[model samples]
Target: MDWSTTIATQVAQIPRSGIRAFFDLVTGRSDIISLGVGEPDFVTPWNIREAAIYSLERGHTTYTSNYGLESLRRKIVTYVENFFGVSYNPLNEVLVTVGVSEAIDLALRALLNPGDEVLYHEPCYVSYAPSVSMAYGVAVPIATKKSDLFALDPAALEAAITPRTKVLMLNFPTNPTGAVAPVETLEAIARLCIKHDLVVLSDEIYSELRYDDVRHTSIASLPGMRERTLLLHGFSKAFAMTGFRLGYACGPEPLVSAMMKVHQYSMLCAPITSQEAAIEALENGTPAMLEMRESYRMRRNYLVKRLNDMGLDCHLPGGAFYVFPDVSRFSLSSKEFAERLLMEAKVAAVPGDAFGASGEGFLRCCYATAFELIREACDAMERFVDKLQKEAR
Candidate 1:
């Protein structure tokens, strides 16, 4: 039963995702209404799918260049500059990745040395902490507060820094909590990073999915930030293209160069079909994306109103499809509450604690499903909360 000692200790140290526990319990149960995944419920747009089919029909089955196809990389540049107000040289600065997941892994793998430190906020996406650890980096989490609209405090961020700090990760339009950072907060954080000479890894995959007229401002777009920021985005949530497995990173030539080495060995290229699909997602998918985003906004409005009506303290998310309701009034552990509701009411939500300790008193519900489904989930929660209240009395 002995294994290699390198994997023995390291693998044991990797934290099990709190979100995965629900699937472990409910797998093969046909009745679970899962709001746990942070993806749009819509299928990939037909036009994008057709592009993938076209690529396959053209016999593009083999691996592309280690940095990915040149045409796709150029499309990525035009898309970023046009949509995100951030520009990078397509030839030197962009590397297509297999989902933002692989872009993140590639960056961490290439940059971190053993015992280096990286910082990010919590109630974060499930990947950042363990992924950094996997790269032999130590993670330092700064607690973001709901009171501040889940804003990352610049003071806390500065305090978390050390001589060992190698990079900082930022994820806004965030997961579990649908919190987006305003430009001012990003500017302040950028100031500290510049002063301390830190690299920033900014994950902005949900930028296009915001509610209101709230435009997403990339830290990468701010003064002097383009050089230090490793910007990660993809076509998943924006274009309803999660299955396409295409993402890209934009950064300084040197960082992109270093990451391409890890990417070459690990992923080679994002599938050629997906790259073609992604290019279409960039070019022709804008109208579909706008429609999808507005649908998510309607669902958000509905769920937030219903949760508030039931006396749950839920807010309309600024971006992304999730609603993180403060469930402390029920006086239940987030895990216990989520499981009991899934078993009793057949509505599956992620426990906020799935993200981190600050997430302990909340439940994350993705409102990306059909309005009927969101209605059903809200109805189920109301009945369940009433029963809990009766029992408490």
Candidate 2:
């Protein structure tokens, strides 16, 4: 039996996630100080965990509506309206998902026809391109630069637009780079979406992790964007609920309904227990979220300063837990640099090009690890870099 023809071409073409191999390499190594994965080091807040337990205790274990629990959906409405100034009707405009991952997949599947184009900035989360491909849509990369703090260039976006362009996927408080799109940039992109008649899929999962008094502005909140934007968010980053696998998509009725159709058959509904827990996260988890955000801010400050002081060019990340530092001076590809750092220093960081080609000369260090571990990783990295410089000499 020839299995080559058995596998789908798209599945075969998709490269394995670069983040996963490093994670596997360090899985049981106690000596490795990892700043690789974006997972939050914090435990889920007691209140949120308790809510899930309470739901189980009350025997609320049956399948929820395919759209998720109505109560949870209503809370999601209130939560988004309060935090993002966006109004969503719980009944027809919100769909609970397993994670923002699933929400994104559902949106692409629901929206894109064959050969349609999906535009997203490069050095983005690893999933965007593959997800677009799986949906049979073209993944268009818009390169953003470090000099501009990785903010999306509206001119670049405008030039990328074509008749076949169907969606604009955005992740801010972006992964890998930790760039946040400013209100003006988002507004400009929003206007272009209007001009092109493109649907927007704004993944704001890290919106709660902004630093130095920088507030996250959701593109969906901009005027006229609400109807055209599918906003994806989850509890993983902000509420330390990564294990719970709860997330949602909210947008206009038609888009939400379309996504829900795909979600219903594919996912049915998000876990009932996780949905109940998410309600608690939105309702009573604000203080805990803020506290965690502050911790990340402090770590971000320390890591950026230490990396720059060591002669690595690192910019202050405006949001998200990752910092992308340029490593071109080392005269190695990002993958080679990461491998050498892991082998020589036992300090694990992700190779930036894992996110996209535009990420070739950088590395992503996640600060979501413990502060002491982060400091240790920084120290190890500095020594490793010093050794490399000496060798070059």
Candidate 3:
């Protein structure tokens, strides 16, 4: 009768996502101004939604190929090459999965043996280490510091490499910190990966949301990287299609084929309607994406400035929708700071430790909320911070 005995060991050992766990306290609370979840505030563009509706009207409701609809695959590859400057054959080198989450699982499961190690930067998305663990791989973290703008350190990555290391997982324009990898740093990491012969899982879902004219250079696009890198992207972020849950993986034929094998037996295929909608998103969703990007840029500017003015020590993140501000000065743990902020200010921002231990002294404030709401949250936060400082005094 003990559920603990029946649960898989790996699943039992893996803790629930810290981000979701913290947000659970805010559930059903309509009064909170939330900067917790990373989803875009904008609705999916009407044309893209219309595409899904049109596809449904045409009765395109059946299961697609295990590799996904050929049209969608072609569109995915074209988008990747055009935007990321990394080309792949659409026929055998692209696999449309349920989302970037599924693609991460597929790649890790396909490549990892028991105890194989995955080297990833910390203060990253909550899913990276858990996905590696679920695949029976050892999750090795390379700590990225605020001084480095949270970019993955190539030297740190080199030190983490061992005989057991098999994959390097990267999420640039990263989660929590909004750190974008520099091209030179990426080139150095790419060199190390080449020397070590490690497969790179480049998760560039936030690649399109970059700010301040910060260019996103994919590790996959660097010399000697395309053959060994799996590029993961989707419509969830830029196109505001989170509910559709559509994403794809692009890489060498053999790697994509291997991921497809696992995906076929598991997910089978991404939803047909989502795939059709994704096709539209890739083909004609640019102007809307740009507008949303600009809005986020404005929000990011306002939020970061407010945090710094309130003495939170936040660096201007170059990409993504989140700002990680150092809260060590408040003399409270990240969790305590965030919990008090929610309860007292009715403002919800994620504790940075929700991402990883390296995030212990910080809080992640998402800028994807409406600008007006973000302004209100800032006002509340300023008052909350002033109260905390007075208590210390």
lDDT of each: 0.88, 0.93, 0.94
Error of 3 at 356 (Å): 0.7
- Residue 303's lDDT within candidate 2 is 94
TM-score of each: 0.98, 0.99, 0.99
Residue-level lDDT tens digits of model 3 in 46-154: 9999999999999999999999999988888788888999888889999998989999999999999999999999998999999999999999989999999999888
Model 1 has an lDDT value of 0.88
TM-score of 3: 0.99
lDDT order of candidates, top first: 3, 2, 1
Candidate 1 per-residue lDDT, tens place, 58-177, comes to: 998988888888998999999889877898899989999999999999999989999999999999998899898889999898998878778799999999999999899998899878
lDDT (Cα, 0-100) at 160 in candidate 2: 96
Distance from true position, residue 185, model 3, in Å? Answer: 0.3
The local lDDT score (0 to 100) that residue 335 gets in candidate 1 is: 89
Candidate 2 residues 164-185, lDDT tens each?
Answer: 9999999998998999988899
What's the true lDDT of residue 331 in model 1? 72
- Candidate 1 stretches with Cα past 4 Å from truth are 3-6
